[model samples]
Target: MNRVYILLGANIGDPWQQLAAARLEIEERIGSIELQSSIYESEAWGVTDQPVFLNQVLAVSTAYSAMECLDIALDIERDLGRVRLKKWGSRVIDIDLLYFNEEIINTERLKLPHPYIQERNFTLVPLVEISPQYLHPVLKKINKTLLLESKDTLTVKKHIHEHL
Candidate 1:
């Protein structure tokens, strides 16, 4: 089985519940979930006119291939009513495959370790929370380093006391 990191986020209507539901769907579609990060509230990244988002990172152990994982993620988003009306627009649920083991893959539909995980604090913050020692295959640095060097830390806050 491969260990993959998945980033979950939602900004429209009951963000927490959307995230929790997305997790359940992943377990049902794939297999077991290895680890889950604490939920974090963050401001909008690309389009700043929308509501804040609830975000977290999950580590999953699965036997599925990269494309299989992408398909599962797309299924979850579609099932949760993810509308790609605009770039980084508000949505009901958004599931992104952040990393797939140490694989360096780049296809038309998927990119391992995400193309911009290092630049976004919303992803790296929760990522380092669950896996501080995680090493980036392309950057050759730990997650902690990425979190520290990230320049886009505007309004990222962890909601440790709340539930979806």
Candidate 2:
């Protein structure tokens, strides 16, 4: 089985429900989810005028290859109402491939250990939460260290879920 890390983010509609739906779809399409970080809320990364986002990190055990994982991740995003109108645009859901078992891949479609992993608080906060010791394939630094060194000034807060 292949182990992979995925980042989930949403700012449209019922963001909480969107994340829940994403988790369900991931479980059905991908393999079993091994670990998950607590949800976090952060300001919009690139496009500043949009709504804040709810984000989470997941560790999944899958049987698919890196390419297949990307394909499935895109499919999941589309299925969840993601319309890429612009770079860093708001969406109903965004599933990003963060790391694939320490593998480094740079292709036209996907970039493993996501290129922005070390630069964004939204990605780093949850990453440090779940996989503080997980090393970046290219940076050769742990997620905790990456978060510590991140220059991102955005506010990332641990989401307070209202359990009903």
Candidate 3:
């Protein structure tokens, strides 16, 4: 089995319900979720005029390759009403493939150890919560270190505490 980390974000519709539904779809379509961070609420990253988004990082156990995982995640978003209106536009659901094991991959459709991991507080905080020691394949820094070094000033507040 291959382990992958994914980020789920939503700012439209019932955000909590959207996340729950996305999680279910991911488990069914992608793989078994071994670990998930508590949902974090933050201001929109790129498009600042939009509503706040609820985001979470999930560690999944999958048998699929990186591109396959990306395909499945994109399908889940489409099934759950994600539309490409504009860059960083508001959405019902957004799934970003953050990391696929320790392997470094770069393709037109996917990028491993997501290019923005070290720069976003919203992505870093929950990632640290679940796997603080997970190292970035390219940067060679742990999640906690990335979080500390992050220049993103966005205030990411934990929305729901997870038991596991």
Backbone clashes under 3 angstroms, per model: 0, 0, 0
> Which residue pairs clash in candidate 2?
none
Q: Candidate 2, which segments miss by more than 4 Å at Cα?
A: none
List model 3 lDDT by residue over 1-164, tens digit each: 99999999999998898999999999998899999999999999988999999999999999999999999999999999899999989999999999999999887777787999998998999999999999898999999999999999999999854522
CA lDDT of each candidate? 0.90, 0.93, 0.92
**Which portions of model 1 show Cα errors greater than 4 Å?**
161-164
lDDT tens per residue, model 1, 55-80: 98999999999889999899889998
Each prediction's TM-score against the native? 0.96, 0.97, 0.96
lDDT of 1 at 9: 94
Off by over 4 Å in 3: 161-164
Q: Is candidate 1 or candidate 2 better by TM-score?
A: 2
lDDT of 2 by residue, 1-164 (tens): 99999999999899999999999999999879999999999999989999999999999999999899889989999998889998998899999999999898988998887999999999999989888998887989999999999999999999888831
Cα miss at 163, model 3 (Å)?
14
TM-score of 3: 0.96
Best by TM-score: 2
Rank by lDDT, highest first.
2, 3, 1
